[model samples]
Target: MRFYPYKLACLLAFGCFVSVTWIKSIPSDEGSTVMPDLQILYKRLLVAEELGGQVSQDLSSILEQLRNLSKTGNDTYLYSVHNRTGFKVSVVLGIPTVKRDKQSYLVNTLSSLLFSLTSSQCQDLLIIVFVAETNLDYVNSVAETIMKNFPKEVQSGLLEVISPSQYYYPDFTSLKETFGDSKERVKWRTKQNLDFSFLMLYAQDKGTFYVQLEDDVVAKSGYYDEMKAYATNEASKPWLYLEFSQLGFIGKLFRTRDLPMIAEFFLMFHRDKPIDWLLDHILWVKVCNPEKDDKHCTEQKALLKQRYKPSLFQHVGLHSSLPGKLQHLKDKDFGKQTLYKAHNNPPAEVSSTLKHYQTHSLKSAYEGRDFFWAITPLQGDYILFNFSQPVYTSGYLFRSGNIETNGDKFFNTTVEVLPSSVLARHKVAIPHYRESGNGFIIVGEFVNGLAEGKIEAALQPVSALRLVVHSDSDVWALLSEILIKV
Candidate 1:
């Protein structure tokens, strides 16, 4: 194994430099139940090994191959690429769902997507929900909910809800009987692959790229913005596919042109095994020539696949589609997400109304410990942070109200960023979680007080920041940690 050094530079997406480690490690077993990290260990193979002698000689040949693969396919009988607003679509998010007896996560999942995405990112994005259940009434009901919740997007042609025609995808009765009762898992999974294929085909012609996700998943904040940054960073590089989420068929990204080949591959092995394993086999074979005698190519090809560190999508707690399965899905990188390193130096001065909760003082706000709780919340409460001088502000994070002890209580926080020179201010809405079905509390560290929401306003160097409640606090506010990037 060869380790490649990727220069620690400004992440084209975040506008800041970050250090990334490169290491040479052995590959994990393919059959293991745990999903491998699948990070593309960057190596300059062409410059280090092959291209030194033939840079100019084989440039045309390489360019020609890329052109062939990237060219729009000759098949005109593709999905009807419809956008009601006439906006050019760049990303197609494909979600395939089924009827569940007790658990439904589609509303939560859709809500997460909308809240996490910025208006700029949503402009060129299309979300296609494919209802792949045998019950037509269930499908229509789900579609109605989607239409009602996201009327703006649905009317704007930003979202599409459809189901596979029965003529194309018949009842899986024969498949179930073929797999038999004892092999229920196999039968469920086999039908799942067919459904995925249907989703891919439907989305293939709608956009430049396609990503498949399950019905029950929540996205990280600023996911679309982060993807744009990642794409910018990867513009000069060659990659086979990009994996966004670690779950099954949830975050596999592909070029729309490649969907035909992938859908075909899925159908070819639909009866043989699970769709996830089938994807692994196909991608491996697609990148590495199975007929080639050289074994080194396989190792090199494996590095072409990439994934976002600390995965961006989390699975919602729900009953599994397959019987006898319980799900408590959590990514290793959920609440622990640190977009950038914390600025060690605190602001010039920090003060709050009811500054002391027992022994916990507002001075210990940045103590870097969750144990030292600096807590207080009252009517017309505010935390005023003053800076001696102007600083280029990137973002701010504040954790309020411990959840383990108090059971998920948060105060509605309104953050105001006032630039030293400008009259305008940057305002970010920090929502508190109510019993109502809504978004994850903005910057709420419910589990351990660790959530951080980035600033989305355009502003100059900051002079000060203010955190306060938009309404009267129904519960006592607890301030665990307050962070700002200078």
Candidate 2:
């Protein structure tokens, strides 16, 4: 692969320049600087790479492509929104997300991916969240959400959030419809290609291997160890990539050394096909012959890639990022999941208006032996935890949805607490909290399938804790975790 380098003066200027200083000369119509500090951040990256040992040729090429794209595409410059410096890990996972019309699974996906990694594995892995949008507000929202949810991971440099510059994408207004797809569909696939290419190129130099993932997938526990072990065992083979999930481009792993070629290939035909088809084409180009029969070509392409059974990731998002589309795709190869976690808690009587699914009952979930899977919850459905005694609870955490049933989570559900004092005084009005219909005080609501926070001191010696469903839900609900700290 060829690399583009900056001049010696630019390299030297980086050493002297303490901060990015904007120069105003013939400002544009938007009142933006005609020539901004595009090279400053990139120059610092090159310097950091050089200091580490040697600058990556693939990274240099990608940086040059961004600079060129910025010049022609949009006025805003390309930059990382939330990032940690000095990272070189064994594996880098890239998740490309777009603004969805329905609920976003990004947070749940992230939580699951980071849930099982140990300290050693955390050090050896890096996760990059590529928000594939030009809207600053949306990008910032994702960054903030990630920061709030995974503060430790963000601080420890295990997770990074980045967005492409507005100038990174070409105009889609002039795209021609192809493959019987609508113009909008064609544009969506085309932009997806660009997004994958950009993410791959950016991750190429960050780790020894790169794994592609969607923002709506849940990873199996111990996925990192399993993938690494399998890849290491097959290190001597000449395979192009390893498939960890049967679904389209969910857990595809590739060598970082080959990313330049792979990313270039995707960029070359980005407008022609979907990202997954383009990937298969790469395998075809490497091993298949044009004159061969379809069966022969398929056999040859199969040799270049290996598929592992019991998929490590599963797709759960029902709503596609593409507007007005729904995706019900699931990975059949993904095996069973840990439906619930075992925890010791104070004795309490558990009752629910929601009907449980199969053997997964509310009593089992409260006892910490199994998850609580219920049918579609209707308005006024509630899960009541009546304490055997008035315990001084300090905090509580209720997590819905397991790895296998990721979408089956409580929606618009509030966690309410009934004070022991409420039993004595009927219809007591709490100072700050709103009282529910049955004397329970609304404390917190489930956000992104998780309700976790410290209980206020004012609500001490709680008599009961209740989860009240405000609206009816289409999908069933599942509670995988329930913890109450006393």
Q: How does residue 486 of candidate 1 score in lDDT? A: 61
RMSD after CA superposition, every candidate: 17.4, 14.1
TM-score for candidate 1: 0.55
Maximum-TM-score candidate: 2
TM per candidate: 0.55, 0.60
Q: lDDT by residue for model 1 over 1-486, one digit each (tens)? A: 111111212122111101111122334467957543443323333222333234222322322332332232232111212333323467788888887767888877776666534456777788877777645566667767877767766765667666644344434455543434446676788778878876775566667767788888877756776765675577456665677777766777777877766766676567667888887787577676656655765675666667876677777756888766788776666454322222364556877775565665656555444323334355556666678786776676665533223222345555655556533332223233221111112222222223455543344466666665556554555554467876
Candidate 1 clashes between residue pairs 3 or more apart in a chain or in different chains: 445-449
User: How accurate locally, in lDDT, is each candidate?
Assistant: 0.57, 0.78
Per-residue lDDT for 71 in model 2? 34
lDDT of 2: 0.78
lDDT (Cα, tens digit) per residue for candidate 2, span 12-69 = 2122221222222212446744444565556555555554232234335455654444
